[model samples]
Target chain A: MRLELKEVASGYGHRTLIRRISLVVTDGEVLCLLGPNGSGKTTLFKTILGLIRLQGGQILLDGEDISRWPRARLARVMGYIPQAHNPPFPYRVLDVVLMGRTAHLGPTAAPGREDMAVARRAINTLNISHLEDRIYTEISGGERQLVLIARALAQEPRLLIMDEATSALDFGNQLLVLSHIKRLAQMGLAIIMASHFPDHALLYASKVMLLKKGQVYSLGRPEEMVTEENLKSLYGVDVKIIRAELPGCNETRVCVPVCR
Target chain B: MAVARKQGSLTNSLATAEGNYRWREIALTALPLLVFLFSFPLGRYPISPGQLLTILAAKVFPIAPTWPATLETVVFQVRLPRMLAAMLVGAALATAGAAYQGMFKNPLVSPDILGASAGAGFGAALAIYFSLGVVGIQVSSFLFGLLAVGLTWALSSRIRHDPVLILVLAGILMGTLFSSGTSLIKYVADPYDKLPAITFWLMGSLAAIAPRDVWTALVPILVGTLPLYLLRWRLNVLSLGEEEARSLGLDTGRLRLIVILCSTLITAASVAISGMIGWVGLIIPHLARMLVGPNYRELLPAAILIGSAYLLLVDDLARVLTSVEIPLGILTSIIGAPFFLYLLLNARRGWV
Candidate 1:
């Protein structure tokens, strides 16, 4: 009774971009997808989120096929955190987060006290409540990324899919966001996040799926599969794996690309 | 820490922003009423305020008629209808402009984004070329305005690209087609009779507004504006752009279609009655946004109030400020462009 994609195929009209991809995501687990560009990472996410039609196989959410579920209902069960976007108008951060409560409200109904309360709770949890009243466009890229995550949290979905969630953040914000991602998993939310950094997967992901050329190359525990040999094959860049101990952080393995 | 205050929701800040101009809003609302009251007697009729009230009351209720019959006619037949038409046209244009700006996600776009003004102008020109009566001209103008927008939508829908870009390109194409049609008709008309009529109508004035014009414009304006005012919050979501709005579970296609339909109705109705009063739709929404923040909930009402009052003031000036009344189309640009430029030059906050 969790998210499962069985032999799923999706693409635009008459052109199949992704074919026969299978993955399972359960509660309290974080699945990090690592891939290069043109590997169909985006098409896979869009298909799972029901943004595009799935041409083959079934997507089961908690034992129910949800490939054709209404978007309004899908919004209740799953939330998507897109890459940071600069809205044309300068909406306040609070207002942007409050938009996450749309599935709970009717078409013409304004967000009520209850909905605002939920939004406020999400902002507080992200520890960026100081940004609630600031103009969203004027904020830094890192802050915008956090605000997007907070907005997804406000939706209170069972599964959260994040596309490049931490790529835009500064180093400190990267760590903070990684910790938050781990904390959300601890709270029993299933998370599937696409990431460029395999080190992030090593630090936070319970399962890592390495995608290559529109198919899964490897899927297993990060420590077992993220060897120096595999990363070099995946990215065409020579890389070295090292165990490092740093102050205030546990002794952990890190992936370092070997310079030519 | 300082983040979590004792306040309950986001409305607390919104309430404070409203409080910033509580008295101002009251004054703006009262401005229309004051103009309506003082306007009754200040015309060529020269009726006093007391007589104006008595005449108005006598019309509405079965009271003892103390006012002169001529005064009653002036109050009911001439001043009342013109004043109502001016206010309605102003309010309609302003609200529709604000809606278009929000929906298209660009502050520069006005209600004419769908080519409503050009289409209506061409329709009026064609009617004049045929020597149609006043009512026939207005009806034809209103229908053609809708037709132009419908054509734009139809063409744009076939492309399926970025919705805003496609709609805008189609609108420009249709706008050019209709406006050139108006020009062709102008060239062929009798220089003395038809050209002057088309030119004056295009220049725009509320000087000859009749009660029937008011009645025809009011129904569509009210009907169109109700949905926009009620669903204004949805506009915030829409202004986020289509992809983001869809990710938030909003039906962007349906919401956009409704907004275009309502805005098209109001713009066509106003242009039909008042001709091409150009800047009310473009500038009033900007002024409203500066006064209130970009929150559509407050922005829409603010535009309506300020627009009605601003146009009413301009129409009053058109009546008494000169021996020969200046057209509203000319006056609006003369007044609006400088004020807008001043805002741009000495801007404290970015309008976006």
Candidate 2:
């Protein structure tokens, strides 16, 4: 799967928040988006996901225009994992995952035994099969995040879009989820993720895109694009990038903010 | 491999859950039938269980007439239509309420959140003030009910902001508007006749339900319910909120419109026949949720069965508890309020 955006622009009706953003992601690649609040990271994502109308340019999948495709067709190809939030009803976890099969089912059809198998496969992939029968509302935050990811996987999508999926989890859970994301990429799923942490991008992203003032500031390999200068300019904060070598581990880069 | 082993265990647990769910469905399916059978012997005429069975079986079998013709009249004419009407109205209101609650993503929402009841009440009041006959009153009530929700939908559509919030606010505004219209009609109505008639209609009752009323309400109720039943799975996705549902490839706008249209049709038809029977729509869905969990696949059917039994039982009490027949609206409120309070206290067990 290949997703290419050519000079794409979008925003709320008649107000352009982001423009001139062009990027490409293919199978087995993870592209991480880094931006400050209101910097159009969400707008760019919404545009790509066809949640909002495109103001200009075109989005193509495998060199075919997809801007005019129906929402169900788009969803079949691109799965979305939203930030975890509570719904009003107490749906079981398996039921929650089964909702991802909506795009595949007919307008009036319910999920069948085959769809249930797909949902169960998604749960197993997330290693949360034990939580299948538990009430979704009663689960912990990290567990809920994993459930959301499993829901996306149930869509059987080739390209996955996540909106700060780990922003609310604890540090250890964040790493756990990120590692799972890396494994999914290894399985040949194309992934696009928005992140607040540069270290997360550094650790998991094969490619990184930096957005500032509603435009792409840079886009390249994570090591080349995520820098101390870029971080300072993006968030207007002083920061240091350090490579630490720990015993029984490879050298890893970490971002450290310097306090005045 | 470990994950695959766990998946096997998960399937076993799911099979157990499916078994339990089927049992609950069986119980729910039986409740209304049991209540329907048990209710025949409880009315004012005092038909014994053997007599009730004899009367019911005589229609199918070649049994000779062992009971008076009046017993047949009371059984067929009086109890049967009223009981059927009670179940129909109850099931319709509850189904509409469940759909509305899911669409609006608020468990507190009821079938009349979009002003269908208030609009129908105003129509009945106006028809009474003008001395319209029974058919005219029902027709006017049903049309005005549709009109009020239509107006709310139109008003909300004109605004481009938060769709759900705008829709709810517009519904409230329409509800207040029509309710005031009803009050204004009441103020001008003749105090001797029209005022009491209007007041009684607003308080809601099933005392005048004829056999035709049952047939009259059945068409719209089935029309509305079948679609909702077919779309039950989507309602679950919809309850996840608008953006999530949309990203999952649902056209949220279209689904919301269908839900609103169907719910309005059934609610108007119900209010047209039974007057403004309240609390059934508001509380029966919650009761059903408590019984069967919140999967709409099961929730809708459970709600229908429980609602039918609930209203049948309440109507039975209304018929025999006192010399004067209590309005169903009052009885449902009197009963529903305390039960709702209990639900609120134990909300975590059943709801989020």
Candidate 3:
């Protein structure tokens, strides 16, 4: 196991935003958090990543207490890409990816040839090598998200935490980013991403975590957790469950949210 | 086994990064050194290149004891310290400007636009209004300049989490208030002696710089500059807004505080000595950004080199134009304002 959050509770300034959230992500696992707009999904990621103070409970990484880890040490172990990464100045796409190596960089140490090579490889992995020298701000939203994922890849972390990283992408770009995430997990990374779409969670994730009202509503396999009843309860809309097979794999479709 | 594989890959990547970065550092440092060395021989008192080299060698090395008195005086007493001081102050202001722009995440930000220069002028003007002697003027100007910056900082930061717009607005408001007070002081001063002194001081000239003033200015400037070098990379990350910087393991509040403190002190210290020399801080960093991209590690040093070259080239023109020493602000404004307009019109959108 790479990351395990045990009964974790956290919030901002005396307000308890998320509570009793327990989950474990093993290597090669894609665990997606499904919730509505105010369902504390982002807060859960922040608590696990230690961006906000954890009010209660323990977060352990490889059996070490995550609370005790210094931020730089935590960064080396786990990489995070927030939903919105706005750049005030126009940095080249390659430069943005190279920033992932910052945790490894020393006080006066420079970004070297190897760092560029890794950045290049990550960009290639995301099929964004052609956009390497383009201005980050000028690129389309989908391209920026891929570049940011490449940045996360450059960190070479055991666990990746993404908060709505694919929310800005179109339908096809959304699938592309999730497939990239699936590939990273297949390569032994533990991914915990907060996403609004339950369909995507069911499509690619090995595990699904349902958060409701600052608590974990359910945590288990996506096959059992993403049922028609669970979708209706979580999203307060009736959902129809359907199963189909794609050319290469099985597909589980929950169609009630689409009806109305 | 997986940990071993990952560790091996990480090290391989790191080693490559280190190698590339080292060459860039060498190139950056070397180019600036060569340019700084060559700038010294360019002025009209133009020692023959050979004589200039000979004079430099004699001073730096003990083997050559005999040197011409006039050459020695021109190189050591007259030109050397002035040139070195110009280089140091230019580097200080431009680097500080780059740091300030990064901290604020605004390309238009400059060292003096925050009101440090206006405050320094007001402080110096107050000293003149009292008819204080030379010692009195320098001391009061230095102290009041510091005080004005302190006031601006306090006012801007009064409400924790003040927006950048609010901070900028406060600086502008404070700057206008101080400038008006200075105008009032100028109006009341005696027209004959005090008025001309104030006018010339406001216009800014390096003609009166002495070796002693250089030493006095060096202490605060260097003290403020060291922190910037240590924090250069962090400043680059800081340009991505406060929340992202914090999540990346940087103490954004502390880093911002340290940067604001250092850049403000450096600006106030330089303005205290140089008397509101404009555009070296404002324009040079923009040119550096255009040349080297927004990465502060490269941009900072580039700004230093280009800024020194700029001020020295312009100062050289100022001296050769007439027997009357032209105010540096007038010269820099004439040169920088047009170039800035050209950049605004020509640069690609979002490049800044």
Candidate 4:
């Protein structure tokens, strides 16, 4: 499935945060949206999920307008992980993940043998099966992030939308999550992620959309979009980029931004 | 695909486990009901349990029946209504308490937090001062209880964008306001006669319930409670948080309104019938949650059954343990507060 945002304008009432935004996320690819702080990445995500009403234009899933899709249907088709949502209760990790099966279960249907199996497999795939019985509130921040990603994966969505999912993670956890997401893209799930890290985009993204002040500043392959000129323009800093050889790919480098 | 198979097996195992656990829950619920029904026969009136059962059965299905002594009339006319009133009020308060806790997603929240208790107290106090009859007190109780809930709802609505904080603040504010009004009413009442009457009503007793009062209160409670019973799944979704509930295609705004209305009605009706019973509402739901997981379908019914059983046992203790009938409120707080503390410290592992 392909997601097309054509001239989509949205915001809080009377306050247009994102104006005339347009982008595309095709199947079997990872499109990373890189932006500076307060650049409306979260707002763009909310608009796409129909949490915020669009002031103008439309969003299309495949060939149909998605604005009319019910939220339950939308949740089934597009798995969303919103940065870090703290559940008020101390739910078990497995219970949290099973919520993803809401779209599949009937109203009165108890969690059947099938639902539990799916949850365990998602946990195993994320390498967090040991955390299943652990209280979600008791887990560390990185482990919680992995569990949340595992929850989204359990939805079996065709499209995955993540809003700054790794912003609170440690460096190692961030890399681990990005690699897992990259692997999911290889498995044919369309992934759209918002990130503050340019290197993460440069490393795992097949395509990049650079959002500056809620507008699409540029969009293209990561190699062509992550130039020092674009980074300087988006973040207002001079960044030194060094090319290095990684274990498997030539697309390895380091970005050291020198604040001026 | 692997994930799907894993979730499938986990849910399957849980279902079978739940099936077994469910039978145990039913047994726990049934034990209390049986004991309570049997208690009615063992009281001051020496109607044998077998004879009481025969009498009750004859009332329902009469082919030919034998009547007992005049004391049987005393049991049926005097004690039965009061006992049923206590059990029903207890069940109503506990059910509403569980609903509020789930709706707010806060285990600590109770129906009384909305000023309904204080409002009912004030109304009952006013009715006593006016020397209202049984009918007058019932009307006044319903009116003032509804008034308090309406005031709390209005105050909370002003800051609708942040409902939880607004709800807490509104409840506290209204509770304080109504309590002060009750104090003022107490001061003005004739200290010798009306003061004692007001104080007794405030302390809460089910000793004076008439059949008419029972029918009046029970109707509204059942009317309010049935909808909550039916919408338990929606309540489960609500516990996840308002944002998540909306995302799951539930009209959270409407659901919240319905829950609040039902709970307020149940609280008011129970208060009218039995004065101002506390602790049962606040504590029973937590105990129910501990016994079963936080699943609302299981939790709500369990809370109701356990609450009815508990109040019956407590009332029996209040009567049989001493010649004097202790205020049900005083007895419950004495037992409930300490038990609540124990649960708070020891049961944190199971709580979410």
Each candidate structure's TM-score, on Cα atoms with residue i matched to residue i, is: 0.93, 0.96, 0.83, 0.87
Maximum-TM-score candidate: 2
The best-first sequence of candidates by DockQ reads 2, 1, 4, 3
Per-residue lDDT tens digits for candidate 1, residues B230-317, read: 8898898889887667777777888899999999999999999999998888888888777776888778998998889888888888
| C-alpha lDDT score of every prediction, in listed order | 0.87, 0.92, 0.79, 0.82
True-vs-predicted CA distance for residue A193, candidate 4, Å: 2.0
Which residue pairs come into collision in candidate 3? Answer: A112-B17, A113-B16, A113-B17, A114-B16, A114-B17, A239-A256, A240-A256
**Model 3 - which docking category?**
acceptable
Off by over 4 Å in 4: A63-69, A84-86, A104-134, A138-140, A154-156, A258-260, B1-23, B41-51, B57-69, B158-160, B348-352
Candidate with the larger TM-score of 1 and 2 = 2
lDDT of 2 by residue, A40-59 (tens): 99898889989899999999
What DockQ does each candidate score versus the true complex, computed on alpha carbons?
A: 0.56, 0.70, 0.32, 0.34
Winner on TM-score between 2 and 4 is 2
Q: Best by lDDT, which number? A: 2
lDDT for each residue of candidate 4 in A59-176, tens digit (9 for 90 to 100): 9999799988876778777887766656656667987787777666655454568988998888998999889988887888889888888878777888888888999988898888
Per-residue lDDT for B116-227 in model 3, tens only? 7888888889988897865566677777666666777778777544446666777787789889989998999999988888988888777777677778878888888888
Looking at model 3 chain A, report the run of 10 residues with the lowest lDDT sum. Answer: A251-260
TM-score (C-alpha, index-matched) for candidate 4: 0.87
True contacts kept of 3: 0.29
On a 0 to 1 DockQ scale, where is model 3?
0.32
lDDT, candidate 3, at A137: 85
Model 2 per-residue lDDT tens digits across residues B1-352 = 9999988997898799899978987889999999998887887789999998888899999999988999999888888999999999999999999999999899999999999999999899999999998888898999999999999999999998889999999999999999999999999999999999999998889888888889988999899999999999899999998889988989899999999999999999999988988888889999888888898998999899999999999999899999899998999999999998888888765462
